[model samples]
Target: MTVRELLTEMKDTSEVIIDLAYASLMYNSSTMAEKVRGLEDDMDDLKFATRYKVLLSSRTREDARQLSGILEVASAADRISDAASDIVSLLRFPPEKRPFITEMLSEADEKIRMIKISSDSSMVGNTIGRLQIEASTGCKIIAIKNRRGWTYDPEDEMKLRANDVIIVRGTDDGADLLVEYAAGRKEWEFEEIVPDDVIEDEAEEDLQNEEELSEEIRGEGDEE
Candidate 1:
């Protein structure tokens, strides 16, 4: 890949890592946290690949200077992903006991969600941009997984296919709405005045209680 393409890919993966990591924290999912770590490893490989390619291509002092700037930008993206991973690392602690951290999470306005396109779904054969997910449901598609593997920051014309897993970040209500639409359940779509389930843990009932307590301590009501 060219340096510009690599840089764009770096930015795309960077967003996915951080967003998914923070989502892991909010849901207390070790599985998701580990996934972010795996993605971080992928990012490291991309970094090395970009550097190696650039080293071979740098032929002049001016080229070296610009390449250095590109490397710096890529490093900054890596750092942001690292910071998000650090946040996920703290999820090993119980949320109830970490009242401060839980409080912070409770206040998060954005959330991560994933939806799989069904074979019969209207979204199956359209481009992401054509779907207008952000414009329609206020959700941003960050990554797409298919036979081609994960495509981060796909262009407007990038085709959506059956069984493509789309990762998105947006408000809880918006994400829910989008999930239904993406899954060919448009009839089930509705405005979520209060999200039905905010926590993704298997022991959701207990976690909900803990979250309620955390909110009470923070002088907030239970999540609907």
Candidate 2:
């Protein structure tokens, strides 16, 4: 199947899985497992399509591996969604118990802040550890989208290469700091005037690093 076809199938199957999870949460236990089984079947079909696309395409092995990894993540997400719904179902206790449950859910949801980072930015070149340090100084890089559209976890150790968009979770001030950092401004210098010499030196260092990294990669390729 074509990439579009595979993607469409994946989307459809994913929706089915979501629907099953919702149904399980809203309905009785007698029928919940059956619906979950059907969802599992749909997930299997998605995996099959993903495998077929990877195996039949002329893409490089690395590309295929990446695609496989994405499918695996999707599968895992589906499972987690199902589990979350199951937990939600358990919260269907009497009215007295629901207030506490509602408060817990609200607290859980409120703790997370979602902010997207533009793909084209200096923050893309930084490592996760670097991003985390920046976050601790008040900007959290919670997730990232690599070129393949797969989201990277905060601690994945995958360097934030250019063209990767990131999602940060933090307070409003923290998110603002992240945006400023992504735009190449330090938190402490957000409002301060940048000296020309500092800018020039940073630019020179960046260019030198780019050339060195390129040469290193090229040398590795040659050795291989």
Candidate 3:
């Protein structure tokens, strides 16, 4: 991968690792901890690859000066991954010894939660951009999992489907609202409201269609 692509991957990977690492500790899941460890390995590999690319690209004094910043960013991302790995290391202790983890997470300003979309949800057919999920719910989607695989930092144009599992970060109230929408228990309301005239027009159209259907049925009865 090019340096830009590698850096993007590293950023996404590091962010995911941090969230997953804390989630692992909060939920007491060894599986999540193991995933963090694997990602840490990947981060290391990315760091090395990035350095190799940067070194090859730096051909002069000016090139070296410009390229140094990229290395700094890569090192920062690597340190973030390392910190995440450290967070998950608490999993090595016995459950009883680390009971405070969940409590600490609960008290945090932002909480990460995984929500599954229901088949009947209004969100099933909408793209993230159309939904304006963050604007309405105040929760930002971090990752999504469908049958195909996981998408981290999903794009605005990404469409939601039934049974897609989304990981989001937000306040408790925001999470609850998003959960309700995802479960089909609540309808989505956007900042842009349809004009009353437009709604009335639609209602009039439906009435006209119903009347036309009735007239057709009556004419058929007369023929009989």
Top TM-score model: 3
> Please, what are the lDDT tens digits per residue for candidate 3 over residues 1-224?
99999999999888878888887777677766787898999999999999999999999999999889999999999999999999998988987898787778788998988899999899998999999999999998877888887766689999999999998888999999999999999987755777999999999999999999999999896787
Q: Tens-digit lDDT track for model 2 on 1-224? A: 66556556565545444433332333323344454555566556666666666667647878777777766765665565456446545534644654654454335422233434445465565576644545354544434567666442346466777556654434566656666656556532323447999989999999999999999999897787
lDDT of 1 by residue, 170-197 (tens): 8989988887877787842333444445
State model 2's lDDT: 0.54
List candidate 2 segments past 4 Å from native.
1-83, 86-120, 133-139, 187-224
What lDDT does the true structure give each of the candidates?
0.77, 0.54, 0.89
The candidate, 1 or 3, that scores higher on TM-score is: 3
Question: How many clashing residue pairs are found in candidate 2?
Answer: 2
In candidate 3, stretches whose alpha carbon ends up further than 4 angstroms from where it belongs are 125-132, 142-165, 189-224
Output the worst ten-in-a-row residue range by lDDT, candidate 1: 187-196
By lDDT, the best candidate is 3
Candidates in order: C-alpha RMSD to true structure: 15.9, 13.9, 17.9
Rank list by lDDT: 3, 1, 2
